[model samples]
Target chain A: MTKKQIQEKIAFTVLTMTMFMVVIPTLLIIGYIIYKGIGTISWEFITAMPRKGMREGGILPAIVGTIYLVMGTIILALPLGVGSAIYLTEYAKQGKVTRLIRLAIMNLAGVPSVVYGLFGLGLFVYFLNIGTSILAGALTLACLILPVVITASEEALKSVPQSYREASLALGATKLQTIQKVVLPFAMPGILTGAILGIGRAAGETAPILLTVAAFFLPRLPKSIFDQAMALPYHLYIISTQVPNMPQGIQYGTALTLLGLVSIFFMLATVIRIKFKMANRA
Target chain B: MSKISVKDLNLFYGDFQALKNITLNIEEKKVTALIGPSGCGKSTFLRSLNRMNDLIDGVKIKGDLKLEEQDIYQKDVDVVALRRRVGMVFQKPNPFPKSIYENVAYGPRRYGIKTRKQLDEIVEKSLKKAALWEEVKDRLSKSALGLSGGQQQRLCIARALAMEPEVLLMDEPTSALDPIATAKIEELIVELKKEYTIVIVTHSMQQAARISDETAFFLMGEVVEVDTTQKIFTKPRDKRTEDYVTGRFG
Candidate 1:
């Protein structure tokens, strides 16, 4: 065979191997979780309180708490993050101040989740005196996801052509007007995807919530924002490690449940992205 | 009456002067064509009309430019309001990623025309003036990006017309489109001049000759000639202008 044919064979072989390595493991993990978790999924399991052993008891409070936390984080983070991104991309001049601000945000995303947890505990719980409440933890997670949301949204907004801004400006639209009417609607899908991804990451987080309001394993429902809550990841951690003599089956179930929730969040984000793409194509 | 007048207009980007000291009168409700080689500053001059170049960083200007007999570079002049009277269509068709209806209604809505009836009327009338309403009437809900290149170009024109500006500036709009689209846009220009003062910058000599009522030829940041289209194309003028017009050297 010629040298070109041998090189082509090597390239294809490498590409195939890489694809399989990534795909097989992902499918295997998802398959294992579904196989184990499907059995544990019941109306009672989803709605029942944590009265008995975690295996027999339902995950009702944890499910509700997770949803509440995700909602609060989204409500708290989206506007602030997207607004800052808009200022950086559209309004801010490219100079020392902007560059410094950008660098700080990039570093914020890199800080360990545990550090964010500590910061949240000190700032929200201690200083602000919110004190071991769901609101406190939700606020913390908002900060944790803020940098990701801002950076992703900035990238999305920047992808829109500058000519669109020029067109709006030339047509007598004010800077604020141009952004609101033209630039934003165009960048909405991408910005939403970023927020969704941030929400997913915030939903799956264990360490940050563990040090905050998620440290509790309350047997009853949270009455208000100040009430302590048990999240899915923390429930998984308590079931698998903290609880006494937990069954192997229960640990696997907990793992499967945690994975299921994160996967659902991810799938929802993907569905939203795909819907936008389909509509854009149509 | 002259709608826009420029006097001793000079602009520099950092240190390199993009436009020379130029003075001219643009009459109201007439089609003016600016023709030049690449980087001859015709587009710059065009952009300076509405302070569109103000968005660029480090662009310095020393000149007196008047619109409707008011000095545009006046310190207290509202740039946004000034721009409302002068609408620009770019060299390439850049439609906002929105439905055709929303794209046309954006300008009116921004200026507080919130009544659904009023906005609908504006969209319909503007699209009709652009001669694009029939083509897009059936698919107003579709994304502007879904349209063909020619259709998108016309949609852009309709969008600008919706703003009800006094002057329309087009910077080589047909350069990015096919021959058929170019012809349609050229025809639209002739129809537009009846109500709005229209100025277009183009690289096509034939296009300048065919559609323009008045043509201004630029060379090395200077206006070499400006006169009726017939005179610029047929009669002998300056040596450089005549040679360049004859395709000797662009």
Candidate 2:
């Protein structure tokens, strides 16, 4: 073969190798977790409360707490993020103020998740006097994911073809009507994708919950939004690092549970996104 | 009788002048075709008629433009109401990603026609008017995107028709279609003119000659001539119009 053809073949091999590099590591991490933690996953482990400093028994409270936090975050963030995105994409003029707002949102996305935990502790937990509770934790997590949702939702909204908006307007539909009927329907799948990303982040994050609401040893379920609760990430953190001579199996099992919970959320979001996508195409 | 009138109207996009001193009369129940090369503002003029240009940023309009003796550019003209009275079809077929029935029913539904029976009747009537009912009546519930390009364009026309507008603006409505589809749309436009005031922009001079009652030649953001389609196509007026019609230059 000519030198040029040999060079091309070498480039293709290198590129393929790098692509596998990404996939292999991801599979290894998941496979390792499942292998180590699968033995601990049982009916009692999932349904029963932990015993003896979380060294034995199930992580029921952590599981429930993470669910509440995720639901609350979604409730608070989805509408706000989607609304801000709509305003940014459809109504905001290309001006200095709008540009500034956009810049701020981008920067907000880059701010570390720990900063969001601190902000939540300052605003929702202390200043509001709501104390460390599910409300505060959810609010913190929502803030952490707001930038993701807004940016993703804005992209989704913008990806809708401009012709749809023009057609709706020319047919005498008001601006709001056009957005509601034509724009939003087409953008729903994209918006749900953003929500899915936010869910995974919120469920996996320990820092935000650490400052806002995570209880070190809460063994019971939260009675209301005002109650502090144990979450999987924080539970795993404490079990892995804080407890004396913690069982390695329980530590891996907790990590596995968190991973599983986040995966379930991803699956739910994918189902919703597929439904919207089907509706749009049909 | 004039259905819409424009006198010394100018439109600007930021620093660029897109339409300048455009004066013309669109007669009631007649086809008025604006023919010009690309970027000569033929499409801009059509958009200005119904204030669809308002959607663009930094667009400025000056001078008088009216519909049925009412100043459509007045501050309180209610653009939504004006648009309902003057619907539009685009150069490309832009049927919403929805069912054929929903695409036609969308406009009337937005206008507060809520009853299922009422929507069904309007959808059927509009589709029939656009000459798409025979082909698509059985598949009204199917996605509009499933239709051919020609059918999609006709669906857009039906969508506009559902609004029950007195005036219709078509911007090269057949530009994206095959010759057969173009012929179909041309025939529909000719038939539609008997009832509605039709203002169309076309690159095809033959299309203008074939279907237009009044033909206006636009050049460099100005109208070079406006006259009976027969007079403009044959007798000639300005040297520029003659040259353009005779294929000497664009």
Candidate 3:
């Protein structure tokens, strides 16, 4: 019909095609994994210890290890990330130095996870003598996720209206008090979302933990920070590629378990985001 | 008697001067309104009272600004204490994203009032002072963002009053409200003058005539005239003041 209508139709079609291209692959992968692995997931599979040269029984230690790693990473990253974000957004003068620091953080986020693994190997494993343990792995993952946390937190901090700060300051609150009582609370939900996303990334990471932790055949759970642990991603990697003649059900189950763990983190973040949005509205 | 005094006050934002040679004395328990065209530095002058201007980088102030015989611009002056003594309400309503009670209680809490009973009393008293107590008394624990624009503005006033400041600086407090809301705030301002000295910046000339005890017309960063609202409105001294009053020009 009309030329304008034809052009609009073409543009809409192109956008829909691009959206499908992105959505299809993600759904395909997740759907395939669920189809292949759903039968393998069970209460025993989630809670039982591995046996028969990692070909039988369950992946209880790996699940527990991932939980520990995620917790440690959050403990290390959240405060440091939020603090740096506050300084960058509120205290730092908008000039060359601030710009440079922002650029460095962006670059840090782009660096390969393998490079982080090597750094962890050298620093946490050997130089620091913390050894291949949960502490080392968590610290390494913390480093890997620090940039994401900082950027997200900075964005959250920036999104808070300047009017709130002015109101607090004008009401006789000191700068620190205003930040603590007003600004921080307003930005808390956003900061938490960022932290949860970071935790998810840290939980799913294999390379950083591979060199720093990931005990291959450990039947017992890590009792201390110094003890080596079996993480989900690394366990999946071992079962699927390294372990000779590993059972198909076990490999799919490990993959499914890792996916489930990461999804839980993402779901948690979504729930929190929604709750905060409702609270803000109220 | 003068509660706050200024002598040849000049303010600059980087290279551009915003307020120039502004000399005025604000009396205790009086409603003094600063009226001018947009960007004539009326709002800037209001902000200068509590050193709220200090928050802006590249801002420079010269000459003397004194509150009750104390030079507020002096380096040794405790800005936090000064702000506590002189509170401010902004042009737009800015209630914190908190309960109405928490919004009012925020100031006293900062000064280390932690008990719920004390905070509750202060919140009620401040809200009553701002003429918002009866309307919001039931919803004190509810989020303040749920209130209407005018209510939110009154809530902000209540928040400022919670600090128990002697001087209240309002930067166009009702500019964002409907006519009914504006009238209510005007009534509140008149009632508030019995206790606290008030300085307000408004764009509405009719508003200044209706509420202000004294009026200062700012023109191009200078005080064109400062006198009793009646004299300034009826028998104006300067040609610019006469023209501005008679709706000749801003």
Candidate 4:
């Protein structure tokens, strides 16, 4: 074979190997969790409350807590994020101040989740005196995912063609009317996808909820926003590391359940995005 | 009678001047064509008629521009009302990603014509005026994006007409269409001018000659000449206008 052909073959093999290297680890982790936890998973394990210090019973409380946290995060974050995104994209003038604000938002997305937990603890727990409750956790998680929602929503709003805005405005529609009648409708799908992605992220996040709302041993569902709750990610962390004599199957089962919950969110985002794209095409 | 008048109008995009001292009167119920080379401020001049230029930041305008007796640049002038009076169609077709019916009805609905009967009549009349009703009448509920390029351009025209504006500003409205579509739009322009005053910016000298009663030739951010289309195309005039009309240079 020619040297060039040989070199091409080698390059292709290396690239293919690198691509699989990324996928293989992810598949192995998921496979390992399922293999270890499949025997433990049952109808009772999902429906019943904890028994014997969460060593013997189901994870219903954790599941409920996660659902509540995710819903609250979405309720609090979606409107605020989408609103800020609309202002930045449609209303804010391009200037030094706007540029700085954009830069700050971009940087806020990169701030570690643990730092967000500390901030939430200080602000919501001590300053506001909401304490380590679901309210505090949701607020913390909302802040953690706000940057994601804002950034994604900003991208979605900006993706709308400039010509659409011009057409609406040229038709004698007021600025607000143009946005309401034309811009927002086209941008709705993108904004929803961004919000769903933020929800997915909020569901999987443990650090922000760890200090703000997650209970170490509480096995009951939260009655109100002010009550402490057990969440999937923190529950998994506690069972795997903090608890003594934790069963191998139970640990992997908790991991698998957390993965399943997060996967559901991601799947929802994909479905919504695809559904809107098809609607747009048709 | 003049439907609109401009006097010593100057427009600046930040520091760069785009339209310089453009003074002209657009006659009532006539097709007036603005023909010029690229970057000759024809499109900018067209956009200024409806205050569409106000959407761009750092844009500065100095001079008196009037739609009839109303100075449209006055502090209290309602831009929305001004736009309703002077509608615009873009160079490329920009129908909303909606059903054909919805696209046509969007303007009237926005102006508080919410009753279904009124909207239906307006949409039908506007589509018929734009020469697209017979073709699209069957699929009024179909997505406008499914239409071909020419159909989309006509849809845009129908959308603008739904507002019932006194003047329609078209900026190279058929630039993105093929020969057949361009011919169709030119025919629509001739027909539309019987009721609504029409101002169009076109690169095609033949198009201006075919549809326009009056023509203004702009060059380098200024109106080089304004006259009857026949005179501009046939008779002796400024050397630059002659050169541009005869394809000497852009």
Candidate 5:
């Protein structure tokens, strides 16, 4: 073989090996959890309330609580994040102020989730007098995912062709009207993708929920936004570490369930993104 | 009577001047063409007629511009209303990623034409006026992006026509089209002048001679000459206009 061909083959093999190093561990972890947890999963385990300190029965309350928190987080974050993105992309002039705002969003994304938990505890839980409830936890998760949503939404808005805006404006449409009729529709798929990704991240997050809303062993479903609830991630963490004599089967089962929940969110986002793409193409 | 008039107009992009002191009057229901080399301010002049230049940041305009004796540059001038009366077609075809019917209906819809019957009428009339109705009549519901480049350009014209503007601005509208499409657009321009005042910017001198009744030649951010298209093309005038028309230099 030629020297160049041999070098190209070596480079390709090295890249393949590097990719497998990342992929193998993820597959192994998921496979192990599914294998260990499959035995514990049953109709009763999913539907029945927890019994004997979460060691004997189901995680229905935790499942319900996670759903509530996700919905609340999406409600609080989607509008704020998308609005901020629109302002930055369309309305804000390119100057020092815009640059500063962009920098602040980037920094917010970098801050640790644990820091967000403390901020939520102090702000939403205590100062606001909302206490430890679904509202506080969802607010914290919303803050944690705000940067993701804003960045993704801004990217989506920026992807729209400048010509579309010009065409709308030239037709005598007002700036707001142009955005509503032309810009937003073109950017919808991207905006929804960002929101779905944010929800997925919020669903799997434990740190922000821990200090803000999660209860130690709440077996009852949350009755309202003001009530305390049990989330999948926090419940998994508690059973795996905090609870003594916790069965390996139960720990694996909780971890698998949390992973499955997050996977479901990811799959839903993918489906929605595909639907939008198909519509756009048509 | 003049449909639009400009006097001693100057435009600046920060420190760089894009248009120098210019004065001209555009006759009503006539085809007036602006011919120039690239960056000679012909397109800029066309955009200024409809105040499309205001979209750019750091753009500054000085002096008087009037549309039908109304001072368009005044603070109280309703830009949206002004734009509604002076519609513009871009150099390249830019049909919205929507059905052909929706693309043509977009302008009327913005003005609160909500009923489907009214929109259908406007869309049909506009498309027919643009010479694209027959080609797309059966597929009004199809995506406009699926059409060929020439069809798309005509669709854009139909979209602008739906606004029912008094003046139409074309900025090198045929530069991106093939000869056949270019001929079709030139024909459309000639036919359109009976109803609406038309100001078109063209890089092709032959196109200006063929389609416009009055022609203005721009050079280095200034209008060198304005006259009947025949006189500009045939007779001796400014040395620059003569050289530019003869293809001596840009």
Candidate 6:
């Protein structure tokens, strides 16, 4: 009833509310993902190619397509992404161009996935004439992931101590030699981690693929860069929305399969992190 | 007649001059000590010997830095080769996060020294020169980062020595070390001077008085005086040097 007691009560009430507000939503989202996604899990659901409207429909082609996408995307994105990151972090001075490029990448990450999808559809499919295929989807996905790849890679390279560079140079190594010998190895783990995250983002991407590569259905696996492909998310959307005789288990299976794929990518990331930490400790 | 001649040198880190017009002749195969307060540019001047200031983003230099009468900053000079001839040891021990053997091999490897036996010999010689051989000899494959702080710094010194540079620069090499490590490093410095031209910057007046044949005193970027270590410490030519040596002011 006293003022001091009232203040204490209000402080406690706000603290409790704040904690619950953060904790409850995070727990609920994680719980919901597991609850809705844990069922329909099996190797059969993930490794076999999708068969629309069937309980046994597998995401084999979609899985293969995703892997192909990751490969092509990494090959295309890693060089440019890491190279630009190195240039920015190591060589480039903090000037207008560097500042502008950083600001642009930040804005790009913030842009909606649907917006990225439309741009991919326009740039990769329509303009580049790659057509509706794995390559186009990958090119699009690579573009989608480039900003994150560059930012993380730049941070990683920057994380290397200036003393390392100085020590290398003092050893009579040239500037480029110092970076190649000392800076690059130290930053390698960070770049790998960034790459793994980029791959995950690229793999889990559904909206962009829908517009660029997954717009049309292919009963069979894509035969070439010009051929249409099946993606798990698109397959899930199609089976759940378009197919009349689609089995109930197919949607759950596809969702669970997609969840597993993303988790695999994350596990790979964790493994790489451990490798870097161990290397540093050693 | 000395191995290194620095004449009328001034250094500025973007208009804030760090070293005044300073001149000193460093004898070959002899140890020279540069003693000064923090921010007095002893370290800055030491870096100039190897052109290490080029690493600073916007450092400016105006002076004659000559190694045996050859101008160091001339347009024709290769900074890399110059650095190879003049190795530097930093204040804090900074060893590469690599194997003990690889740390020593880094310079020679960069300069195109290949073959396992050759690198092993250099590593062995350099480690022995640095007084680090007995401890690290058996486990050359171990990471340099695993060494204790003092050991790491000595490994860094060994890494620098592996190149077999003509002139060795030590910028407060023992500042980060405890007394035992400092004593070992100081002793090593004195011993190394028998074959190498050594220039060391130290804050400890007693260190300079004990280890150096010749000493230079700096204050606020100016070379206050240059004389024999005994003279600088006991009977300095400049009042400021006398004040600094007597702990009147930094």
lDDT of 6 by residue, B7-34 (tens): 9898889879998898889999988999
Instruction: Tell me the TM-score of model 4.
Output: 0.97
What stretches of model 6 exceed 4 Å from their correct place? A1-39, A52-56
Considering TM-score, which of the candidate structures 5 and 6 is the better prediction for this target? 5
In order, what lDDT does every prediction score?
0.86, 0.95, 0.93, 0.91, 0.92, 0.85
Structural similarity to truth (TM-score) of each candidate: 0.95, 0.99, 0.97, 0.97, 0.98, 0.93
The alpha-carbon deviation from the true structure for residue A1 of candidate 2, after best TM-score superposition, in angstroms, is: 1.7
Q: What is the DockQ of candidate 1?
A: 0.65
Question: Tens-digit lDDT track for model 4 on B120-233?
Answer: 999999999999999999999999999999999999999999999999999999999999999999999999999999999998988999999999999999999999899999
Tens digit of lDDT per residue, candidate 5, span B86-202?
999998898888889988988898989999999999999999999999999999999999998888999999999999999999988999999999999999999999999999999
Q: Each model's interface RMSD (Å)? A: 2.0, 0.4, 1.2, 1.2, 1.1, 1.2
Better of 1 and 4 by TM-score: 4
| Residue B79, candidate 1: alpha-carbon lDDT | 88
Deviation from native of the Cα of residue B69 in model 2, angstroms: 1.6
The 10-residue segment of model 4 chain A with minimum total lDDT is: A273-282
Against the native complex, each candidate's DockQ, computed on alpha carbons, is 0.65, 0.93, 0.73, 0.73, 0.69, 0.72
Best of the candidates, lDDT: 2
Report how far off residue A217 is in candidate 3 (Å).
Answer: 2.1
Across A214-242, the per-residue lDDT of candidate 3 in tens digits comes to 89889999999999999999998888888
lDDT at residue A207 of model 3 (Cα atoms): 93
Distance from true position, residue A96, model 2, in Å?
1.9
True-vs-predicted CA distance for residue B120, candidate 6, Å: 0.7
In Å, residue A1's CA in model 1 sits off its true spot by: 2.0
lDDT of 6 by residue, A177-258 (tens): 9988888788988888888888888877789889888744555667776667777777777778877876666666667667
Q: Candidate 1 at residue A253, lDDT? A: 63
